[model samples]
Target: MIIQAYNFLASWQLFPEKGEYQSGNRPKSGYYRINASDDKSRLNIEHTWVTLENDAFNATFSIIPDGELHDFENAVLADQFKASIADTSNLEISFYKNDRETLHVLHQITPNGLLKITQTGTAPAGEQFTNIEIYHKQMSVLPYAAAVSGAVIRPTEEGMIRHKALTAMEEQTNMQMDQIRRQIELLALQAREIVSRKELSMLIYNARLNFSPVIGQVYYLYEKKTGDHQVSMISPREWGNGSGPFKTFVAKVKLLADHTWVEVE
Candidate 1:
């Protein structure tokens, strides 16, 4: 019987044949092409190879007795068989001849494209075997097309990568903007300091002048205890007007530096 199998993990279609077989419904052997789906991820096999015949094989596999027509009633295989086929792997097949007799076959694929088959006899009704199951594990079906020879890439995975890249770019932009704002604030502070220095220099220059002093010259003045005042051309304002018998002068002076007058002398 023609047997066809599918490997979901590798996305491969396999045809297992032993010898030449013929049926009225079988087609001539040729290259069959399947077109990709709209997303170019899934392949759609043509309709000519979709149906099952006495000789043709597809995703479904069945067994029939010798020298008989298609017997759908006594088929012992499951509706679907799940198996993993790699370069080198092993598989077990069991067949029952009667209620008291059974046969077990172990098929191994070698690295050099040879199948090693081992046969053994087992007791009938030994143990009831169920399906295969693994604990605490789950497999996700990929929504995108995966190449048979390379790593699998999912659409959600690509989206996550893009999201990370955008987040990093946004953070970098924010950092640059903060740096620019800080630079502007620093420049504004320096400008305020410069203006304050200019104003302090102007105050010092003004304090150095007497009532009739020159616009840019430094001088000193003194006020007597009797309400009379004295003006001096030199600093420290030590010369006082002695209009009264006892007179004392308040010492007030200005200094000069950097071509400007400062009220310290």
Candidate 2:
């Protein structure tokens, strides 16, 4: 019975109930309709007192007994109507009495917790149908209907959760990259400042010695073998474990094709 209650409540929430009557047929404003023109929108019933004028009685009709999907099944109703919100609003109920029959109450919210009241002429007076069905939007088959009504195709227990996690990770990665870029720029500036001969020699011998901790220094000078000028910097952590092993930078400038000077700082 809870399933029935849940199904009925869900249907009432999803489908529109009767509002005020328009002309003699169209429902009033604020109703759920798959497709309604400016003149006609389906009505959703949240309160008991809704004016059912015009052809409001059409909602009172019972469904004829059918195979799998009767009015009770959302998917069945959707499929029988070709799964169209626009088209289903115009459809009447299709049911059968041979197996079971049901009639839906149009205006009144019945005590049965029924989305709409169901009347089965074939059932015993005290017997009530207990089967309730739950259905999800068929994305592939009912894309247009889902879009028009803003229906979730299939809700997952973890889809939203996973998406949030991935978003957070991406944000963290961007922050780390930004920090590294800043450090790189700082190192470049330090290298440019190590232009003096004394500073360059200290850097090459101490920082680049592989046994020193004098890091965060820059150096540059001429090199004989490579015959090219170079500038570089190093961090304390990059070369040595402590201050004794001074981590340093070295750069060499070429005086001639074969002559070079080393700078350390």
Computed on alpha carbons, the lDDT of every model, listed in order, comes to: 0.34, 0.28
Q: How many clashes does the backbone of model 1 have? A: 0
lDDT of 1 by residue, 170-264 (tens): 46776898899999999999888657546645654443335555544655444456455554565442323442332443344343344433344
Winning candidate number (TM-score): 1
Q: What is candidate 2's lDDT per residue for 102-165, written digit by digit as tens?
A: 3222222344432332222222354443222112221121111101111112333343343235
In model 2, what lDDT does residue 37 have? 24
Model 1 residue 42 lDDT score: 32
RMSD of each predicted structure: 26.8, 21.0
Report the CA-based lDDT of candidate 2 relative to the real structure: 0.28
Off by over 4 Å in 1: 1-155, 209-265
Q: How many clashes (backbone N, Cα, C below 3 Å) per candidate?
A: 0, 46
